[model samples]
Target: MAQVLFLGGLGRSGTTLVERLLGELPGICALGEVVHLWQRDLRDDERCGCGSRFSGCTFWQRVGERAFGGWANVDVDRVHTLRDGVERTRHIPRLASAAQPAAQVREYASYYSRVYAAAAEVSGAKLVVDSSKHSALAHVLRAAGDIDLRVVHVVRDARGVAYSWTKRVARPETDGADEMTRYSPGRSALLWNAHNAAFGLLARRGVPVRRIRYEEFLADPRAAIIRLADFAGLAPRPEDLEFLRPGYADLRVGHSAAGNPMRFTVGRLPLRHDDAWMRALPPAQRRLVGAMCGPMLRAYGYPLNPQEAR
Candidate 1:
């Protein structure tokens, strides 16, 4: 009877921060981005936020050992290649089928059940955090049955997410060696629109869900954490906030040469907001974002256009 929490949203949203915060709660293990299903490989190139290679890192080693009965020796490059293939096709149904077993999908559900059990046992918590951010996976997990699951639909302003992606594209040398693609404002807005639409669809179908705004969480960390904890059936505690400070440095994973500047182990509760998107995006990009994501923006209580701000 393990509780499984699916934390999802479009990439570059505050899902990472939310994962870390949730990991601090009693008996919870936050597994960051275990999106690789067919390939179990972690290489020097793929840097997990935990400061370790996803495959060889001690943290994941223990997780694999506990969950899969042994470390399946993941290959970093192969997993990346498979991920690239999935992206190139833009076929979510195919990707979902790829994660399923031959005869029946029951085996797939069993695999996830074991994973959740192992994670909960190892973390000494009743819950596991799966931050894969794919709507298809969410659907598959729900259809698989027997897992008590809840979804946290995290959302951010489309312009803000686009601005962050711009920085990621620019800092390819620093962030990682991978040749990340730059997202046009139109594409970014569409991505946000699609992801939010998926979230809404699943939520309407009776999936237990809570929607959290990234900007609002930054504006009030304590209240936000408490609300999220409540939604996840967790009791709020002081240590959770203590572990959320910037630069506190405890969860480093791999043996990478360069440390993440954005990595803060602990510092102050509720980090400051980055409003650079308001100025960083050109007028044309801003309009594109607004125009593409207008419906979702309005659904989330954001202004549809700059003119509507006043």
Candidate 2:
């Protein structure tokens, strides 16, 4: 069975960077946010992690040929419709059943199984990393039983995530303002609690999960990656730890569908901690996120200071 290490968490929580670092390991091939492949990349023709457009990427071209006898044969709209309906918060729990396969789930899993298996074949890596950060998608993969799945739930401070969503970070591939995402503090915090809570439910339902806080990761990425490697059942080598250094990484293109513009990042990848929100974010907004997050922030070890909440 192909080994799939799925990253489940809220967006802008360092999931992309973690995937990039882990992708650099010897036995791991990181495929950025394949959950968005059909809708974003295939339909919209977004830029790939490498500098090429998704459809133009030669690596993904081969993958399409391998997985679905070329992308032309696949129905993108149907895939998305099924995804929105079945692979969602309300529909995922039903996937726990082994006897009766939900037709949509079965079909979706079949599509992804081919993708993951082909990634393994093409990349020659034993582990395929999918940093989709979608709990429902992760649950579908787990319940499908076609592959061996493990989860890494990446989290960051809700305040930081809120601040991040507020910024208009551009996609290097696009000169226009179409692809950017923005979220208010209240929405960011509420989703953060919901996503984490969903992953918690998944864990309780017997999915193997490993939680990693982004702050702790930045403090010592080497240790963090090693812990992750161990959880994925990979033997960590000394060189596998080298990519965590505070410098550029020799990144290559993968058949990733969508994610941060960091996919376009090559060469030096600065592994510094980002705490700009602590200073730049308005105090009121910080407090807003803190209040919306409520006990969840404390549960994640982020104490809501009265001063910050003010």
Candidate 3:
């Protein structure tokens, strides 16, 4: 069975840093956003975290050979069609029911199962980290029945997440021709609520869920890494985490398939909080996010008023 440590949350919630750090521990492999493996890495041929294009990355080449006889044998278009039909927020109720399979959720899930298994086999990792950051994908895997799934739900303050979504960030994995998608605070807030709620539902359904707040991690990254290592079922030895020191971590270039452009980062990576939203965000937009996020704001321990945010 495929053993997956899935990271689920809204975009810009600090998943890359956690995934990258976790890979430094023994017997764990970080796979970035495997949800985009077929389209972004296979079809478009984006850059992997190892500084090689997807086709040139020997690690992925081995995985493709192992998973589907070198990726060409797999039908990318067919998988995309199946993804649209089964792996979306609108398809959750259909996926949640163990009694139903007519929506083709199992068919789509089989593809991911193969990919995850191949990754573990190729890297010899005991657990593979998939920081897809989508609650819909998390729910799909929970209902998959064959894979062993554990979730780490990372949450950032709605105001900070709203602010991050508004800025234009470069996608180096692309040919420098496209920027990451930007979302308005109102829209980000709506997603903030929906994404967190879906992950909460996963925990209730007994999916072995753990929540990590971005603010908490920024405050004490070393402690958080130890906690996360334990959660992923790697009761890490002190030497396994030697790369980590207070306020900084020595990172390695990864062979991740897809994720935030930060996946391309290497060397001494500093861990710090980005509260740019506090100083630069217009008060009006912050309040709008606070209002739209509703009780999910408090559920994750953020104040209803942005000014009162920690």
Best by lDDT: 3
Query: What local distance difference test score does each model get?
Result: 0.64, 0.82, 0.86
TM-score for each predicted model, relative to the true structure: 0.78, 0.92, 0.96
The TM-score of predicted model 1 comes to: 0.78
lDDT of 1 by residue, 1-310 (tens): 7798888788778887777667666667776555543342333334444544455456556666886667554334644543354332244444344544232344444555666776677667777877767765665566556688899999988888887777654322234445445677777777888777777776866689899999888777667778888888888667656555553324433211122233234433346777788877888888888888877888899886654532
Q: Candidate 1: lDDT of 212?
A: 95
Model 3 ranges with Cα > 4 A deviation = none
**Alpha-carbon error at 206 in model 3, in Å?**
2.2
Q: lDDT score, residue 154, model 2?
A: 93
Query: Against the hidden true structure, what lDDT does model 2 obtain?
Result: 0.82
Q: What's the C-alpha lDDT at position 25 in model 3?
A: 82
**RMSD (Å) per prediction:** 5.0, 2.4, 1.3
In model 3, state the lDDT of residue 100. 55
Q: How far out, in Å, is residue 98 in model 2?
A: 8.9
Ranking by lDDT: 3, 2, 1
Q: Write the per-residue lDDT of candidate 3 for residues 1-310, one digit (tens) a residue.
A: 8789999899999998889988888899899999999989888999999989999999999988998888999898999888888778776655655555654677777888888899999999999999999888887776566688999999999889999999999899876789999999999888888888888887877789999999998898878988987887778888888898877889887988888888888898888888889988899998898788867878777877666764
For model 2, state the Cα shift of residue 89 in Å: 2.6
**What are the clashing pairs of model 3?**
none
